[model samples]
Target: MGHRVLAVLLLVAGFVVLAPGTACACSCSDLKPADQMRLSAAVFTGTVVAARQVEGDPAGPTPPIVYTFRPDQVYKGEPVTEVRVASNAESPACGYRFSTGGRYLVFASAEKTGMLQPDPGVPLHTGLCMGNRQVALGTGPVRAGDPVLNGDPISAELVDALGAPKPPSAAPSAPATAPPTAAPASPAASTGGSAPTWIIVAGAVAGAAVVVAAWRLPARRRVRRD
Candidate 1:
């Protein structure tokens, strides 16, 4: 009875030590490419412009690693020129390490409230199990069943599932060119190149009155001489 009790105590101790590792171990289901695309909120091909590990409270959970991407093509969701994706900081948590300047095909999901979000406004999150893989920078045509180039079979599968991708919408078409405003007229041009009609009539009446006064003066002189 004493031996059995000691053995049971040792077994319990072993289980306690192993439990943490088992709980944190990363496991992923074998989902097909199409299924992976469907589950994702946003899918695109981009190059990692920057990457950083977020700092968190020491007593809290591990911080997330964030990658900033310049998207080359968008397969799903609103087209964006730049996107930020956050992931776990360690492999056990399924964090994907992306190198700066390396091109990749990313499958990301919207994480509204979670430890995976490194910042308040970050809209996307990705992991090793999210079907994110690095690809060559070649701009060649994508074909199904080919090796993982920029436009690989996986990308082809995404294209088939979500149709062709479009580039980021251009700068709102420069606000329609503003229709060429006409120049304002000068003060002289606005008056039609003429004086007022009332002023001209007043000048003519003054001249006629001066001539009548001169004629009356001459007649009065002739009458006085007679």
Candidate 2:
């Protein structure tokens, strides 16, 4: 009986050690450029300025990686100079891996909610199979008639589906100069150019009269006591 129990325990330990860990499997539908455009909340071509992995929940799954992008051209949604996009940290989870300097066309969705809610600053999220493809990095804004790069078919497709892209809207123009703050009125100006000259004289005269009356009353009180 002891020999049999020992063998059973050894078999169970071997099974535990040999078992394969579960993995995340991601699936996406084949979507055309037009369909992708319609499904995405924002579409733009940008270069990754920075990338960082956000820490995950200790009790949950791995967190997403965030990439900061400097938009070269905005094809859809509000034109922004800078935006952050989040993706799953693992390739098996369909994360789109972005390099620090690589330029790519991105199809991003709006912010997600719940436990995996993206960073508030990162208002968009993307994935590996979301029709995202790398492009030849270039200088200057994309123009309507500019020549397409040798291997950049994605840009051509985007232009066909979404038309010519626009440069990011200027950084909101410094908040409209705060309306010049109206230059706080001078003290004199605030009080409507001070009291009129006559009013000033009247105040001085009334103050003098009060002083004289008080003096005269004190003298009369002394005389009555005598």
**Colliding residue pairs in candidate 2:** none
RMSD of each: 10.5, 15.7
lDDT of 2 by residue, 1-226 (tens): 5534432332233222111223456555555677667657788889999998886455545677889999988888888898888887666556678889988778887634322323435767787656777776874544434443333344555568766678887754455444555678766676788966677889999999999999999999999999
lDDT of each: 0.68, 0.68
- TM-score for each prediction? 0.66, 0.58
Worst 10 residues of 1 by lDDT: 11-20
Question: How does candidate 1 score on lDDT?
Answer: 0.68
Residue 18 in model 2: shift from native, Å? 19
lDDT of the structure predicted as candidate 2: 0.68
List clash counts for every candidate, in order.
0, 0
